[model samples]
Each structure stands twice: as structure tokens, then as C-alpha cells.
Target: MALVDVDLALIGYGGATSLLLDALDRHGVRGLRIATVDPVETARPHRTWAFWTGPRDAFDPILDAAWSHVDLYGPGGAQRLELAPMRYAMVRSGPVFARADEAADRLGVQAVRASAAALDDDGTSVTVRDAGGAAIVRAAWALDSRPTAPHRPGRTFWLQHFRGWWVRADRDVFDPSSAILMDFRTPQPAHGVSFGYVLPTGPRTGLIEYTEFSPARLDDAGYETALRSYLKLLDLPELAVEEVEDGAIPMTDAPFARRPSPRVVRLGTAGGATRPSTGYTFSAMRRQAEGIAAALAAGGDPVPPAAYPRRHLWMDAVALRAWDRGLVAAPAFFERLFTRNPPGRVLRFLDGLTSPAEEVALMGSTPLLPMARAAAGDLLARIVR
Candidate 1:
């Protein structure tokens, strides 16, 4: 076994870990030795990350694309909407990977390509295997961003699985400046919701995705069939698919531990940073990275932030509980909220922003009977405990 020492050790180099490195460099924390291990040859490559932003986002320097217009389509039809003061932006996985790697090289941080085997409870140490045998490393703090196993005893768990096709056609069939928010004309699962999302990258190129927020995943043929149906429904002709991107995002009531131990901190999805309501984590990742970098620089043991705001968690719990009980329609719940609230406000709410007053008003847009019953029952159980 080989052993090395550093100030920090990172497990993965996804959005969260990469952003932290960038922040640390910007703070002029020079010559800080950090080691990272990820067997994955490159960072995110096959996924697209989209987030809602107020003006002048912190990570705008590396933002790959942005759009100002938003549209929502329901069973009724397409509703065109505009956000004057807010923007919806997307960052591709490859560019994020490149930016992180470039910063690491310039900052002289040690980047190791290895798979982690285990970590000691002492928390500051880890064991990983490279091409050779076992290698042991020690740091003042270690952050693991790998997805944690879900373990919510009685609650149901579902994954939001999606397949996006980057397409270019001979003719323009997509709006270059607007995001197709959701087309709920598709079939819904008996237990959950499903829809299509489109983000126009350019006049001739864009990403069209078929997504499902259900407990189960579709077979290969099932996803293909769904995509075919969606394309047909939108009256898109035989467009060549430039690329296919697919992945899964977990949604569970599982209590993901923020700090696994005093010495080990978790980040990203592994730290339960995924928002329960919408499964959005890009912006949350930025927040987590900022906190982590500051703590590391100050020589304090770092701990992950609570995954979501308390209010947002409560709202998600209410919605998920209602979904589990078959009391509310997912499409209708979203439709009413979007119809009543401005697109920016609704997006912010989904992205875990809003005042208490705004939250209450947004909740009121829904048929309250189902969510109220769920919240009441949840509170009663808490009281009993």
C-alpha cells in the first residue's frame, strides 16, 4: 500500500466538486494540495444540466447556453410565456469537465484516476485502487460525492429517468429561444407523472427529452416507443438524431446523511442535495461548493448543508405523500401552479426559492384537499413521535 497526505481528498469530480475547486482557486488559496479519485475516465459527458437563475449567476463564466423565453404545453395546448428578468440556462457535461480539468492543471492540484475501495471511519483517510495495488491517502477532510444508497423504510422511491436526443433537421421545427417546459399530453403512470421537455440550443439544434417521474423505469423498447410517440405528437418530421443522452435521477424520502462522520463530508447527490420536488441539483451544488471551499480554507472540518430548505422539503413531502396515496394528479398540480404564477416565480419555487408568503400562495393554487390531508397526517405522526 502507498500513502500520501494532502489538505483535502475528493471522491468525484462532477458539478459540485469541480465548482469547489474553482472557488478555492479564486480565493487565492495557493499551493493547496487536493487529491481526487474517480474511475470514470471523464467527468459528466452524456448529460445536460439546466437551472433557473436570477440575473448575474455566480457560475455564469462557464455557462454553455441560456434562453429567455419559456413555454408550457398541457392537454389544453401550448402556452407561450416570457421571463423578462430571469433566464433559464443549460451547461453541458463536457464543458464542465473541461473547465474543471483546466483549473486543476493551472492550480496544480493532484488529479488521480482511480476507483475508491473504502474509507476509514476516522473519516480523513481513504483507500483506493489504481491500475496497481491499493493506495492509501490521508487528508484533513474528505468529501464523497457518489450517490448514496436510498433507505426510506415505509416510503416509496422513484427515479426520474430521461432520454434526450440532440437533433438537427433539414428544416427548423423547434423554437431557438424558448424552452418547451412540459408536454403532458403523454400517458401518465398509475402511480406517477411523465412528460417531455425541449430546450432549443440553436435554430437547427436542440435537445428533446422524454422524462418520467415514476417508481419504475421503462424497457429499452418502451423508451424508444415513448420518444417516437412524442416526436409524432409534436408533428416533427424525420429529423436526424445528432446524439442521445439518458440518465436517472433518484427521488426518495430517504434521509441522506449530510456528514457521514466528523471527518468525512458528503456533497452533490451523494449528500442528498437533490431536490425532492423537481430533482434539480445544479444550483444547489453551487451553494454547497461555496460553503465547502470556505470551510476548507479556514481549516475547519467541512459538513454538507441540509439537502433542501425545510419549507421545500415539507412541500415535497406533502406532494409525494399525496402522489403515493393517489389523491392528486401530477400534471394538473403543475399546470395550475404554472398558470397562476409567473413562469419565473414558479421556476424559482421549483428551484427552492421564494418567500414564505409566496410559498403559501403557490400552494393555494393547488386543490388543497389532498395536500392538506397529507400534511396533517404527517404532522400528526411527528406529534405522536
Candidate 2:
């Protein structure tokens, strides 16, 4: 068969790729054939992603639901706060993916179920291949989001792998209006951070997750044990498990080759959209997709924005260092922050919504000794290298 040609070739169909396709339609970036290739069977089952947003944004239409109040539980107590002028939103992966898929079809983009096997880079054009052989895709630009092996280049890159159980109780046991932000009563790892996350879908339905920010992932037994212990502590024995969701998100500084070539780029977590500290990527991926589409529409560069700014990177470095040194208590630090700071400001900080001054003050809240050392060390490393 003859080779195919397109204006843009997207190599993955995950959140980032889907968002890109949607952006293309929204921005009216036309006159280009696009091909999105992915190994469909590899997509994991549905998982829930929760985020806090201000007003209407690019993805407001797709949000499955929203909550006005979020509750934080720690050693101190429970602090319930309304996310003023903002709402906490949750969207299921299945629906999000389906919506994007339908939008892509409406935009007249070809969707392929095969994966990209290889790439041939020339100065002007980019070529992508599949398992059939060196099948060519002549395109002005090609983007890829296939997973890559972990890179530990003189630094540690941890993952926040978690397994969550969607459970329903015989009686009303959960507070439908409140989403449990974190429960610090859980055991913290010696070298990393660990905590429990609960999002209530209804009075009897919620998802309880066993989360860890460690260099490796937990075994099935480990996750189940932690979740069981948490539930037992909460005295919820009558709850029955209705569904299970699990995922591993990479948190690292391994310089992702975002701009691989003149006509080639990367997007999504594969392009380092995942936060180095929190392992959240959904909203960042949305912003990235919009940027790329806007740039392409105006005959501009299509490289997605670096999800983490310099200040945000520094904040991550400082926090990770403090956690690494065992200087800060996992639950206590978060508890204090949530108790002291307004929910909106704190949520914005977590969502990468703050000025440099605010970011500095946020970092200053950490234990002075360890955080100071980390900041100084980070500066020195930058100077030396």
C-alpha cells in the first residue's frame, strides 16, 4: 500500500492527545489531515480524577459532577470549607475519553488503533511507522505520547501509585457533600509520603484510595491491607465494594525530550505534564492541548507548554527534599497547611495557581531547617551544573 500523509500525526490517544484533537476543533484549526494512533486495548479501566477550578474553563462541559464543600481530616481534627468562587469537580475517565473521541470524529480526524512502531526524522518532514513495517506518514509535525522507561539521572523519580475502592454501605455512612481530602492517620513510608484519599459520590457511595509517593509501587496485598485498615479505623464494616480503580502516575525530573525535532514534539504526561510533586496531570494536559492547538492554528510553534514553571519546580524540589530527609511529618505538614490556609488558595497552589510571592510564602511554611537546606542545595546545584 502507498504511504499516508497528514498535517499532524499524533502518536497516542490518551488525555493529552484527545484534548489536542478537541482543541483543534474548538479553535477552527483547519486545512490539515490528522491521524491519531493508539493501541486501544491497552487503555486502563475507568478512574476518577478530581480537580478544583474557578469559573468556566475549557473542560467545564465534560465534568461529570461538582462539589461545593471539601473536608480535610487530620490529627488536629476535620476542617470543612467551601471552595468559594470555585467548585471541586470530578470526572470519570470513561466519559472523558468518550467525549474526546466523539469530538475527534466530528473534526474529521482519522483514528487508528495501531501503535507507532518507529519514527524517521528528517529536517523538513517527519515519518512514523507501525508494526506492519516502515509505513510512512508524511506530516509537517508528529507528536508522540507512548510510555517510556523510567529515567533516574542522578535524582529520584517517584510514582504515586494507588488503588481505590468504590464502595456502598448498607446504611448511609458517608457525607455526600464533603470529599475527604486526606486522612493522615495512615502510616507514612520511611522514605516517601503516604496518605488516604476519599471522594464521596453519595451518602452511601465513595472511593477510598491507598496512596503513596515512593520510588516504587505497592503490591496488591499492601494496597488492600492499607485500605482495609483505613476503613476499619473509620468503622465502616458494612460497606460492600462495588468497583475498583487503580493507576500509577510518574513524578520525576527526567528531562522529557519535549521538542525532539523541528517537526516532532510530545504531549501529555509523556511530555512531562505530570506535576513533579503531586502526580496530577489532567488539568495541565488540558491547558497544554489548548496552547498547542492555538499555536498550530496561527502557524505558530506547537510545543506544549512546560507544565511546571521554574518556581513550581523549585517548590517541588524543596518539598521532596524535606520529605526525603524525614524532617517533616507527612500528616502534620498537610494538616497545618489545610487548617491555616484558605481552601481556595491552597487548592490553587496545588493546581499551580499562584504568583511568585505566594509560592515563596507557601514554601516558607515547611520546616525551616530542612527546607532552607534544600533551597540552598538546589541553587548550588544549578550554579555548579
Residue lDDT tens for model 2, 1-385: 3577887888877767777888888888877788887768555457788777776656677765667877767778877878868888787877777767777777778766666888777968788887777675677788887776533352446787888999988888877777777777788777787778778878778888888888898889999899998888787867789999888997765566666677778787767677777888887888788888889889886777777686786777666656666666657777766666667777878778787777666666656786777777766766886
Positional deviation of residue 6's Cα in model 1 after best superposition, in angstroms: 0.8
Query: Considering every candidate listed, which one attains the maximal lDDT?
Result: 1
Off by over 4 Å in 2: 41-44, 57-61, 131-133, 149-154, 380-385
RMSD of 2: 2.3
Candidate 1 structure lDDT: 0.77
Question: Which residue runs of candidate 1 sit more than 4 Å off their true CA positions?
Answer: 42-44, 58-62, 123-135, 151-154, 297-300, 380-385
Error of 2 at 120 (Å): 1.9
* C-alpha root-mean-square deviation, each candidate: 2.5, 2.3
TM, every model: 0.92, 0.92
- Give the per-residue lDDT of model 1 (tens digit) for 5-102: 77778887777788777776765556667887776764356578898877777668777667777777875577877876788889887767666777
Per-prediction tally of clashes = 0, 0
How accurate locally is residue 187 in candidate 1, as Cα lDDT from 0 to 100?
77
For model 1, give the 10-residue run with minimal summed lDDT.
123-132
